[model samples]
Target: MPSADCDTDHRFVKSKVRLSVKVAPKKRGSCTRKLQVDKLHELSEEFRRELEVRLDNNEIPDQDEDPENEWQHLKTILQETTGEVNGFSSRKNKDWFDENDAEVEDLLKTKRSCHAKLLTYPNVQAAKAAYRTACSTLQHKLREIKNNWWLALAERIQSYADMGNTRAFYEALQSVYGPVNQVQAPLRSSDGSGLLTDKYSTPFWVAGLSTMGTFLVTIGTYKSPPSKTYPNRK
Candidate 1:
C-alpha cells in the first residue's frame, strides 16, 4: 500500500492540475500611482538624518546588545517615514477620469438643489440658468484636464526615451497599456497522467519542456510528403 504522505502529495498534485485546467486567466490589477524618484530620495535622506539623531540621543535600540529590539525599532521608523513621504493611506490613485467623475457628481448635486428651489419658486429662471452653466463648465473642464494629462504623459515618455533609459521607457508604456498577466500551464497530460509520479520521478520544472515534447510526439501524427508536386495538374 502507498504511504499516507505519498497519497497526500498525489491528491495535492491532482487538485492543482485540475484547477489549472478549470480556472480561466484573470486580467491584471489596476496600477497604483507611485511617488516620484527624486521625492523618494529626499525622503530617504530625511529618514537617515532622523535615525542618526535618534542614535546620537541614545533613543534607538542597541543592535550589539539586542538584535530583535534593534530590528523592531528600524522597522517602525521605516514604516513611519514611508507613510509620511508616500501619503500611505491618504493618497488616492486619481487620474483625470476619476476627477471628471467627481466633478460630474458635484454638478448632479447642484442640479438637484436647483430643481428643488425651482419647484418652490416656479417663476425663477436663475436656478435653471445656473444648472445649464454648470453643465457647460463640466464639459469644458473635463476635456481640458484630460488633454493636459495626455500631453504631460507624452512629454514624460519622450524624455525617458531620449535619455536612452529603455527600462523607464518600457515602464512608462506599461503604465499606459497595463502590465501583462502570466499564468502557469498544468502539469498533467491530456491522458490524465501526472508529469511526476514519485520522488524518483524527474522534477517537473527540470523536464517540463521535454515531457511536453514527448506528449506532442504521442498525440501528433506525421503525413508523408507527396511524391510529385502538382500530381493532378495533368
Candidate 2:
C-alpha cells in the first residue's frame, strides 16, 4: 500500500491536472439577417388561421381549465407554428448601423491578425508593410461605414418629415441625437409666495382665478341710477 505522503502527492497532482484543463465558453449565434415586414405579415396570418381552426374544433381551454395547462397549450401552439415558419429564425431587431458594419468588423479582425503577424516577425519588412496597409484600409472602411450610416439616418428622417409624420420624425431624431432634456417649471403660486402644496392645488388656483375674473368682468357692467344725474351736474 502507498504511504500517507504518497497519497497526498497523488491528490495534489490530480487537482493540478483538473485546473490545467480550460473549458471554452459557449458562443452565441449571430443575427446575420432580419425578417421582412411582408414575411412577418404572412406569419401573423398563418397563426391567425391556425387559431381559428382550433377555435372551430373547440380545442381552446375554458375558464375552468387549469391556468398552467392553458398557458402551456398556448405556448406550444405559438412555438410550433413559429418554428415551422422559414424566416422566424433570422428575425432580429433593427440596428442603428446597416450591414456594412459587419464588413467593418471583419476588416478590423484582419487588421488585428496582420498586427499580430508583424509582432511575431519584428524584423521582417514585408510583415511591417502588410500591417501598415491593413491599418490604412481599416481606417478608410470605418469612415465609409460611418458616412453611410449617417446618410441613411438623414434620409429616413427626411422621408418621415415629407410624409407629415412628425411623431416618426421625432422618434428618428431621438434615436440618432438622443432625447432632449425638459425644463421643469417652478411650482409656486401666482403671487410668488411659496411652493405649491396640497392646500394650494391646481383646482384651488383655477377656482381663485375664476372668481377674480368674474369680479373684474362685473365691476362696472351695472351703473347706479343716481350716477346718471351726478354726471349731468358735473
Candidate 3:
C-alpha cells in the first residue's frame, strides 16, 4: 500500500489518481473543497508562464490579427483546464485541467463570440475619430453659449449701474466678460480708449449721431437755395 498523506486521501480511478483534501475536523463550518490543478495549460511550464504574465498585465500579447489575438488570449487563460475532459476531478493533474475546465472553456467561447460580434461594427479607430469630432463640436457650442450669457449679463449690469444700483455694479464686475474682452480690456488701458469704444451703448450712440447729421444736412440744404440773384441779373 502506498503511504497516505495526513492532509489528504488518495484513490485510483480508471488508472488515474484522485486526491481529496482533509480539513481540520474541529472547525465548525463546512469544509472547502478545491481541484488543485484546475486548468490544462498550467500543466505546461511554458504556457503557465505566459498565462502569469498576461494576467499580471491584464492585456494580451500583440498578435497580427484580431481573431488571432482573441485566440491567443484565450489560449493563455486555458492553461487552467484539462484537455478533452468533460468531468472534474479533485486530484491534481500534471497534464489536464480539473473537471471545471469545460465550464471555463465554455465561458471563453461565449466571450469570443461576443467579441466577434463587435467586429461587425464600423472600424473602431474610425469610430473613435468621429466621437472626437463630435466632442469638439459640442465644446465649441458650449463656449459660444457661455459667451452669449456673459454678453446678456454685462448688459443687465450696465442697466443696473444706470439706475444707481451699487450692488449690481459690483456683482456685474465679478461676472465673466468672455473672450472678446480679454484683448480689448488691456488695449483700452494702454490707449485710454478701444476699438468702437462706444459699443457698450451702441444703439443710442449711433442713433443720436445719425439724427444729428441728418438734421444738419437738411438745414444746410434749406439755407442754400438756388441762385436767385443770378436769375434776376439775366
Candidate 4:
C-alpha cells in the first residue's frame, strides 16, 4: 500500500478484520418432518396402527452397541414410518423453473469453468476475456429468470384471492416482502484477542488509524476515504 503512488499525501484506509464464528454443536439423532396439518386428524388411528406394526418388527437395540448409533437408528425408523403413513403433499412446482433451465445451467457451468481457467492462467488475455463474457451471459439469463418468477408469483396470488382462499392469499402476499435475513456479528478488538464491549474500543480504533495518516472524511453518519475530483472543460 505504501508503494501505491496516486499523486496524493492522503493514504488509503486499510482495515484488518478477523471473524470469530461460533458453530453450534450438531445433535446426532435429530430429524424433522412435514405433513398435511388438516389430514392429521383423519389419519390419527391409521398412523398409530402403522407405527405399532413397524415397532414390533424392528429388533431391540443391543446393550453393547453405542447409544448414539442406536438412537439414530430409532430416529430413522420413526422418519420412515411417518413418511409411509402420512405421505407427501402433491404440491405444484413453480412454472418459471421449467423455463430455460437447461440453457441457464449451461451458462452457469461455463462461467465456473472460465473462472477456474482464469485463476489457472492469470496472465492469459483469452482466459480473462472468456470469463468476462461468461459472467455477462449468466447475469442476463438469471435476470430473465428472476423477472419471470416475479410475474408468475403475482398471477398465483391473484388466483388464490379469486378462489376465496383468504389464508393462502395473505400468505402469498407476505412472501413478496420476503423473510428477514439480518445477522449481527459480534464486534471484536483489532488484535482479535479481546471483545470490544467498552468505550475504549472507539478510541483505540481512531488512534490506530490516525497513526497511519489515512485520509478519512466524515459527513454526518457516513465515513469514507477521500474522493478525487477533477476540473472539466466542456
Which candidate comes out best when scored by lDDT? 4
Local accuracy by lDDT, each model? 0.64, 0.68, 0.53, 0.73
Question: Against the hidden reference, what TM-scores do the models get?
Answer: 0.53, 0.48, 0.22, 0.41
Where does the lowest 10-residue lDDT sum fall in candidate 3? 91-100
Which residue pairs of candidate 1 clash?
none
- Could you tell me the lDDT of residue 82 within candidate 3? 28
Is candidate 1 or 4 superior in lDDT? Answer: 4
Q: What is the lDDT of residue 177 in candidate 3?
A: 35
Ranking by lDDT: 4, 2, 1, 3
Candidate 1 lDDT score relative to the true structure:
0.64
Q: Tell me how many residue pairs clash in candidate 1.
A: 0
Q: Per-prediction RMSD in angstroms?
A: 16.9, 16.4, 35.5, 19.2
Give the higher-TM-score candidate: 2 or 4: 2
Q: Once model 1 is optimally superposed onto the true structure by TM-score, how far is the C-alpha of residue 207 displaced, in angstroms? A: 6.9
lDDT of 4 by residue, 105-125 (tens): 787788878877776787999
Q: Give candidate 1 misplaced runs (Cα > 4 Å).
A: 1-38, 57-66, 81-93, 97-116, 178-201, 205-234
- Give the count of colliding residue pairs in each prediction: 0, 0, 11, 0
The sequence of per-residue lDDT tens digits that candidate 1 reaches over residues 23-139 is 767788886644344456657777677656655665663346787877887776655555555544323334657646776677567656654564466576886676567557766
Candidate with more favorable, higher TM-score: 2 or 3: 2
Q: Please write out the lDDT profile of model 2 over residues 84-124, one tens digit for every residue.
A: 55344342333444457678779878877877676678799
